[model samples]
Target: MSDAIVVIPTYNEIENIEAIIDAVFAQEKAFHVLVVDDNSPDGTHQKVIELQEKYPERLFLEVREAKTGLGTAYIHGFRWVLARDYEYIFEMDADFSHNPEDLVRLLAACQEDGFDVAIGSRYVKGVNVVNWPMNRVLMSYFASKYVRFITGIPIHDTTAGFICYRRKVLETIGLETIRFVGYAFQIELKFKAWKLGFKIKEVSVIFTDRTKGKSKMDSSIFSEAVFGIIKMKIRSMFTKTKPHA
Candidate 1:
């Protein structure tokens, strides 16, 4: 098994699952994948199973009965990876928005460079997103700024789903206490890591909107992130912060 495992959360992502898995495996670096499928009726899980036959050791799957929140899926994957011997655990999307090629750079940021968490950031290099409306681009950009102002975390892309974390960092953070399941969940995890004195590095990447699959973004997820940041910030005041691992 590889030292790294990439966890991808999927819903109705049948159109993108196969290609994404292939793209990840095609990378020069050795990285295993775990697909946390929420019982996609579109047969997303079956596609993963088929791929697993070819990459028996590199590819794995976890199917759930019903659709749960994205945060829970990742939390489950994190716990599973921790139980094993993976040195680096990643969070990625089943949709092809996040570039698979950038996984190398993310890994380098931690393995070669000295960073505890590496974020595949879209905004660190001046809005590296394509095929998105101006409104959405602004919302996402400003959202990160808002999160930064509220939490005092110096991350550029606060809601970036593509991230690589060293095993020790995840083990240090109390994963069970993670609350929000929407986009805010991303921010919360990063905030807790930063609060605990983990060094986070942002690797510039281009985020292209997925062409084949439907988007999961909605007003509710945005609202959760907007309000959740305040709660997360306030809670951090009372709670004792964990030091760097």
Candidate 2:
């Protein structure tokens, strides 16, 4: 098994699952993949099982009974990887939005550069997103700005789903106490990591909106992120001790 593993959370991503897996493995670096599927009716998990025959050791799957939320799925994945021997853990979309080629750079940031967390950021170098509506681009750009102003975290892309984390960062941050279930989940993890004094670096990457399958994003996810930051900031003020592994 490789020292690094990418955790992809999927609902109904059959259209892109096979190609994405191939792209990740095609990289020069060898990285294992764990698919946390939400029992997609489209037989997404079944496809993973079939492909597991091809990449028996490098690819794995976990099928949940029902579709919960995105946060819970990742939290589950975190716990799974933490129990194993993997050193570098990643969060990526199964869709092609987060390029597989960038995974190598993200790993380099944490492994060779000694950063604790590496974010595949879309805003660190300006607005590098493609195929998104103007309204959405504006909303996403300003949302990161709002998160920075409110939480005092210096990250440019606060809600970015593409990320690489050193194992210790996950162990330091209290994963079970993570509350938000949508985009806010991404913010909370980064905020807690920063609060615990983990070094974070953002690698500039272009986010191409997915062409296949429907988007999981909705207004409720955005709304939660907007309001959740305030409550998270307030709670942090009272907590004095850093979370233990």
Q: Write the per-residue lDDT of candidate 1 for residues 17-97, one digit (tens) a residue.
A: 999999999999989999999999999999999989999889989998887799999998898889999998999998889
Q: Which stretches of candidate 1 lie over 4 Å from their true place?
A: none
Model-by-model lDDT, in order?
A: 0.93, 0.94
Per-candidate TM-score against the hidden true structure: 0.98, 0.98
lDDT per residue (tens digit) for residues 1-245 in model 2:
79999999999999999999999999999999999999999999999999999998999899999888999999989999999999999999999999999999999999999999999999999899999999999999999999999989999999999999999999888798899988789999999999898899999999999999999989999899999899999999998956443
TM-score, cand. 2? 0.98
RMSD of 2: 1.2
Leading candidate by lDDT: 2
Q: What is residue 165's positional error in candidate 1, in angstroms? A: 0.2
Give all candidate RMSDs, comma-separated: 0.8, 1.2
